[model samples]
Target: MRIPSYEDMLAAHERIKPHIRRTPVRTSDYLNDLAGCDLYFKCENFQEPGAFKVRGAANAVFGLDDEQARKGVATHSSGNHASCLSFAAMRRGIPCNVVMPRTAPQAKKDTVARYGGRITECDPSTSSREAAFAKVQAETGGDFVHPYNDPRVIAGQGTCSREFMEQTDGLDMVVAPIGGGGMISGTCLTLSTLAPETKVIAAEPEQADDAYRSFKAGHIIADDAPKTIADGLLVPLKELTWHFVSNHVSEIYTASEQEIIDAMKLSWKHLRIVIEPSCAVPLAVILKNPDAFAGKRVGVVITGGNVDLDKLPWMQT
Candidate 1:
């Protein structure tokens, strides 16, 4: 797995510029006062396909040669990646085969279908998704577009940070949630190149802190059946992403499920954006450890906004 250089990632930014949305950098005095720091939010929820995954997907799909594009693409995604890839494939007039777990939320499955991607339901376990994706690749001869492990995907994701850095200055730190570590890895890499003085932090749910543990232990750590409201962050980091995180990330922080729920509600109320639990990780971390970020100018990436409206965790009571 060859990691793309900072220059290569910037080139991908140019290639996908027309296809992706330049999500806004929003500031909230309320959050700043609460955390005792100036905060800039990168609202990727307003992005095309409702997540930062679209940037990577679009870059991967369009980067394919004619022969590979004709073969189409396959992947296994929990939600955001599936919809983003499906949307990108649809735009490219290519067939997209997504191997999603049967336990995936109805809204996510519906979103994929809406984008014309064919879904293959499998067990929600990592092993099952991997097996099913391999089968799809063998059967359809489709190029496998990994959710976080692909270099092209990482390069595309890095563009988000590039855009954010170009739009804002004087960020003491950049915080993003870590799942399979794609977004954090890409974000950290871009910051390492573009804003070396700015610290990059990986935020994860305490229940799903594989990245945190792995970074501490200096090896890849796999959680055998993790459970968390941050569904997009259940997966453990893979090799390519681990390398980037270990090298560029300044620290890893964990947030409780309740903290994520609170952050989600706060984002909806204050930012007027409906962010899912996973998207709230950065806020959760900030609220949980205010001292770490106090007196610093921070940038938090609100990664996505997709959620089951009828079953929002806060509405259950």
Candidate 2:
């Protein structure tokens, strides 16, 4: 498989510009005081699909050729990617097939369907999801857009950082929540050229710390069914994503379940945004380790806000 390049990211920016939003960068005095740093929140949750995954999804769907478009695209995701790809395909008047875990939030499932995606439910395991997806892809003969592994997806994801650098000046570091590392990889891709001085850090849930483990071990380590409230980040990193994580990422940090929930609530209370648990990982890490980011101009990617209003993690009975 070919690796995505900086030029590809440039092209992806142009190709997906019309489809995805240049999500705003936000900040909070309270958050800055708490973290002892200037925190610039890239509000990807403001996306129409309520996630940054749409950046890559739109790039892949719209970049597809007529032949590929007719067959459409297929992917297996925990949540955000499925809905975003569905939204993009819908915009292009094409089909999207999603193989999602049955345990994924109902809000995500409903959003995918709302975007006209056909979902095939799978067991909540990397093994099971991939196993089921193989059948779906074979039957549909749709081009596969691996949720975070594809070069197109990574290149597409790189555009976010391009906009991030353009929107803000002199960012010392950028911290984004990592699942399969698409966002992190894209951040690496863009920052390597756009702002080489800026460090790219990854935040992950301790319960699902495969990426952290992989980073520390200098190799990829995957968990088939890791449990975490940050469902969007349950998947393990693939070769494409791992390449960037291993080479470009400066560090990987983890936060506990309660930390994630507390951070999620803090964003809702202060940032006044409805963000999912996955997006809270960055803030959780930043808050937990103030010394690392203190005095730095830190940029945090608020990855998504597609949480189920009825099932807030902190409100669990």
Candidate 3:
């Protein structure tokens, strides 16, 4: 499998600049005190589609030619990518069709519709998602934009770390939540080339820790439908992502569901930001293993903030 290079990432930044937001990098003294590290949060939650997924979606959508754009774009995502791709396609005045799990949050589904994308729901499993997406692609004749697996998407995601490194100086480490490993792959791509001295770490949900297991076992490990509060991290790693993870990542850490919730709440309370559970996994791992992060300048990628307000994980009885 081909991996995206620094040049691709630079091109992606230029390609997506007009379409996506260059989200802010925020810091909180309270959060720094709690973690014993100077934590810089790359707030992708502030993105137009409320997630960093827009970076990749925009690259894929805008890369297409006029004829290809007319047919539109298609993909399967838990939430953020679906909404992001829809938003990107809408910006270009093209059709966007997304295959999403039936169990995806209502707010996410609503966002897709609000962006004028058509949705097809499937069972909350990778196999089901792929099957449903195949039908969507066949019917719509749309360009396939694999959420985290496509080289274009990974290249687009690499732009985040490029921006982060530019926003903050002397970062000892960068951490991000690992789902299908697109964002992590992007981080790896950028940091490996631009900031080789800095280490790259991936955080995962203990309930759905295939990436963790894959990292340890030296191969890919996939789970069908592992349940977790960090719903965005449920997807397994693909070959394109595995290539970057196996080569560039320094470590993979796992955090429990409760830990993720605590971290999510902590970010909202202390940092005054609305981040999703998946976005909190990195902070949860940092909180769980403070010794590893203590006194270091760490950059944490906050992936998204697209959560259903009415059905918060902490509010459920």
TM-score of each: 0.98, 0.99, 0.99
Residue 101, candidate 1: C-alpha displacement in angstroms = 1.5
Q: What is the C-alpha RMSD of each candidate to the true structure, in Å?
A: 0.9, 0.7, 0.8
lDDT of 1: 0.90
lDDT (C-alpha, whole model) for all candidates: 0.90, 0.94, 0.95
By lDDT, the candidates rank as 3, 2, 1
Clashes of each: 0, 0, 0
RMSD of 3: 0.8
Candidate 2 residue-wise lDDT, 214-246, digit = tens: 999999999989999999999999999999999
lDDT of 1 by residue, 1-317 (tens): 89878987887898888888999998888888988998899999997688999988988999999999998999999988999999999999999999998877788889999999999999878988898888888999888899999999999999999888878865889999999988987887688888899999989999989899999999999985688888899888998998998889989999998898998888898888888889898999998998999899899998998888878988763
- Residues 58-105, candidate 3, lDDT per residue (tens digit)? 999999999999999999999999999999999999999999999999
Clashing pairs in 2: none
lDDT for 43 (candidate 2): 96
lDDT of 3 at 121: 98
